[model samples]
Target chain A: MSSDVLVSVRGLEVHFPVRGEGIRKKGAGVLRAVDGVDLDILRGETLGLVGESGCGKSTLGNAVLRLIPSTGGSVHFAGTDVTSVGGKGLRELRRRAGMVFQDPFASLDPRRTVAQTVSEPLEVHGLRSGRRERAARVGELLELVGLDPAVAGRYPHEFSGGQRQRVGIARALAGEPDFLVCDEAIASLDVSVQAQVLNLLRRLQKQLGLTLLFISHDLSAVRHISDRIAVMYLGRIVEIGPASAVGSDPQMPYTQALLSAVPLPHPALERERKRIVLRGDVPSPSAVPSGCRFRTRCPYVFEPCDDVDPALQPAGAAGQQAACHLHGVVGTPVERTPEGVTAEP
Target chain B: MGARSGAPRGSEPASAVTAGTAPVLEVEDLRVRLRTPRGPADVVNGLSYTVGPGETVAVVGESGSGKSVSVLALLGLLPARVATVTGRAVLQGEDLLTMKPERLRQVRGPGAGMVFQDPMTSLNPVLTVGRQLVEGIRAHGDVSKEAARSRAADLLGEVGLPDPKGALDRYPHELSGGMRQRVVIAIALSNSPALLIADEATTALDVTVQAQIIDLIENLQADRGTGVIWITHDLGVVAGIADRVLVMYGGRCVEDGTVDDVLERPAHPYTRGLLGALPDLARPAVDGVVPDLATVPGTPPAPTDLPEGCVFWPRCPVRGDARCEHEQPPLVQIQGLDRHFGPSGLPHRAATWCTEPTSDTGLPASGTGSTALGGDR
Candidate 1:
């Protein structure tokens, strides 16, 4: 809706129908994977999307990229309604927006060389004049991601996991897209390699002036890379704020639990820190709980949480927000100490 | 903690072996080769380590570092037709490397147990989870089916699985990823083996699930007095559980010491590079758009196309000249519990090359006929 916004998703819902023979399940049953999500990614900022497994974080990212069709609402990219765009319009939109997948080994064609893998997008968009120019551009792209140009002739199998991911990044940047969605791109890599790739992505984003929608289940990694973070729970945004604010002082119960679960690198801190372990496993999306999706496992859940759904409201300092009744007077008032002081447990 | 007291007492003395008291599973000069189209490709070479009775030893390295291959070779799991293994893998006064096929099969489930990377692939899809656990139990022990089923249920419960009775009747697909991994652990622990090898057991699971599974494995080992050889590439997982850490590179133990010694003050150049690359929350943030991240350039050399001297010399950031390029640096103990590649194959010595501090440039000079010490290439 605004010029500064690169991608705006409002109430976007992606649901798949589940057919069964029992209990009025003919047409009423539907698996609401990505249900009613609202997010805004600015022009050149990295917006991180995080959640546990089966919490619909990946589904939401895919739906925003228009890789998967949404059942309801709209996605507006640079003032263009991507949901209504089709045929040539969709193809044009794809050129301006690219996605880097989780598994680099599976995403790249095994038969293609590194050069071909990076140049395929350029060929598809018909951006290059001749083979020579395309080859040169591929070499430059490889170097941009810290890979050697000499490695251009090698196949994907010859490289390690980190190198393959670099190739994937080079491919994503080939079409000169303004916005990119990296869905768990670093999850399959080792920790050391993960840091390298994350650093590379940040450098490339700044150099190219690109906006990134980084989706991952790893909290520490997302905190390191994101400018602002949005915490998702069962296809809904429970909290949205700056990365530092959300990580250090979480307002929602879900956010608090998620941050607490991350083990600190220092052994002393890890031993002293209290972990908020949720009792049960995550509920299935097809049978999501009514009202608050996290109410089933929320540690601070009460009677009011089951009946009334809380909307996203300002909770943290300044512009941060959270959708939880704890901040309100409905269940228990979140006790706050004096300014700049943390309430002791 | 309450869990610490629940640990079985018989295994307590075995933990001292990691303190150089007595080694349980000792492997020396272990070498494994496969007959490829390009002649013999050494998958595991000159790997040496010891896992005490109750100590949890971690062999950490990237893929193809010979961690998994060495463990599989010890159990005689590699196919005899394609692979040729040599050297000593002594377990409870028996040489596993020289044992007969039939004898090895008998010793596999009882003497040593193994859990693979992916539980779904390791388990049979058509068979029920209960039947699989019972099969592992009955394969080595003399027990009735009813007794085995009950023991299987208890094992499942020990792994923190909900409704062990109900889980026994369900197939692998019905359970979640975490639940399936718990079932695999139950199967691995069914025989009460003295030694357990978990090869990337929790690498496929989510972070929370990974933590839970690691805790479960550590608990089980404490109770059973089972020596553990945890093979993984994740440093985070290794830091939490390992008593002694062995840093492997290009099929050799480059560094081996206590977890605190290796993690806090890593002496090997490779080990230091790996630790420096890790994103620490406690560290101060770097300026500029991109943070200063340590990355080793070039890929690990393939086993078939390994360099002549040190296998890591091509990618080593602190690459010295003639010694690193002309002769293989043997694994030698360095100053104060640190181990690294050195010229002489002696103990209690540091690497022969300069012990200069690592610079922030992230890339050192390549070995270009210039030696740190005056030597011929």
Candidate 2:
């Protein structure tokens, strides 16, 4: 309910119905993609959401933006309840918020030119008057994203993967949205080009004071662009904190395992570091394990982990919280003081 | 052990594969020209390198850099009708380039096994996992169906698959992405090939799963002394698994050296740019300071229309002069600060290229040089 909070999500859930098995029952079961989750995005800051595939990171992002219908809970954006809005109100909500998808090729219309694609948002919201003014705005949007306005005539196929992504960004910014949800925006790009797009997003955020939600599986990239980090696991936020604290001193066991899984670019560090490789692949959402969803794969699972699912609590660090039963355990290492300052390891 | 007993060993003859001596696979001046409508486009131009026994040489490059194409050409994977590959590729003292189709087919499975990028596409959808693995094993060996099936189950167990026997009956779709990749690896190692060509093998998998697969490959390589060619764009994976690194740009080996030398003190501008572009997880994030990721400006040149001089000159931040535009720089040994010049009378090595921006230019040296990197380390 803070004034500075751009998007506030509370117990957001997105569940899909499992289709019929063979010729039997049509609605066999429910696949809880994004089971109860809560998060907040502050104005003008990039909150990175990271998790492996099937972890519901993308589902949560989509639900927040109202692109996907949520099964339960609510998403409030800029003082308006996003989940309840409809018709004009929903269109207005969309105008104030936009989403940039992962695959540039699939997200963009192949037949449309850069200008046509970008100008659609303006036309949808009735932002600018006349064809000429919308065209001018499209030019500005392209320029803002570091693409030459001259390329406006070019089709999506003509531009490279990175350039196509830039066009997507331009389209997203066409409505002049205050909040941007980039779902794995740079995941499909090359490393060098990923850097370019990441820098561009940061620059645009600063220039426009835009609140951004960057959802990606690339931990290094999430660390680079995000001011705050949120780690999702099996449709829930397990750890949330300042990027620095969460990345370096992760409180949750899952976060620790995820960070350790990342291969450092430095050979010496890579060779020296010992990684905690998790045991198995993520369990199917339809048949999620009882109690904590991560209990099946948790390396340090204890008795309580399988009995009581932990909730996010202050991890004794500034703006840091983790959902873990072993937080107070003697040998768990991540103990917090009364003031919420984490004890140094 | 029936599969292993009857089949030719994936490793070369003991005399041919002496560790640390001669390389198991030596590719010299390898060129791959694809027959497009416009003309013959040289996808892989004059590439050369070697994979030593029990050694892992990581080939790093962005998409369309010919890292995969060059290796495919070397292995005769490219269709003969579409690609004209000319090179001297000697595998265990035998010329692979000129070898007959029949001989190459015989060498492919037991001699050299390949694991491709997408595990889903690499596997047969209709075929059960056990059937595929068994078929792959029997392809290179004269073994009974039951023996092959047993060997396939053993291979599955070796890859750390849970309920290995149960997984054998499941189809590709029944497995997770990570499990599919493990199945691919198991098939690749069915005959214990001496040379393993993994082309972005784990790129499609999640980081956690990627780590497990990498460990599996490392353990297998350690046991069998298999020479591995890991083609990937991910620098982090290259740093983790490779003994030596080959940074490819525009179908050429831009830089080649030990992992420490290439990664820590990257000589080539492209390599430096690649390293710089990667967001370092090791570096702590600082508040109020926006760390601008250093990026290489232009896209890689098209194969048909490459630059007249250095392929990288167009995007090189420290490109020297008109000479760089006219002549290609050769790879010169860079042990010391002593400059080694090519026939064009200009320093050709990346080490020399690194020094050119600082030593000669009166302008304060930009941050891509070895001096800036040394401070970073």
Number of the predicted model whose lDDT against the real structure is largest: 2
Model 1 bad stretches (over 4 Å): A21-28, A111-120, A123-140, A147-161, A190-193, A263-273, A329-333, A336-345, B1-22, B284-290, B336-377
Whole-structure CA lDDT of model 2: 0.82
lDDT tens per residue, model 2, B1-377: 11121111122222222344888899999999999898878788888778888888899999989999988887788999999999899988888899999999888887899999999999999999999998888888999999999899999988888888999999999889988998999999998888999999999999988888887887788778899999999999998888778888888888777776677656677887888788888865556464788899979888888887778988988776555677776665554333222222222234223433322212224644442111110
Q: Write the per-residue lDDT of candidate 1 for residues A182-294, one digit (tens) a residue.
A: 99999988766887898899899889999999999887778778888899988789999987778678888888877766655443344345555555567888888887788
Candidate 1, CAPRI quality class derived from DockQ: acceptable
Off by over 4 Å in 2: A24-26, A316-318, A328-345, B1-19, B286-290, B338-364, B367-377
- Clash count for each candidate, listed in order shown: 1, 3
List clashing residue pairs in candidate 1: B334-B349
Q: Can you give the lDDT of residue B276 in candidate 2?
A: 79
TM-score of each: 0.88, 0.91
Q: How close is each model in CA RMSD to the real structure?
A: 5.1, 6.1
CA error at residue B186 for candidate 1, angstroms: 0.6
Top DockQ prediction, candidate number: 2
Per-residue error (Å), model 1, residue B231? 1.2
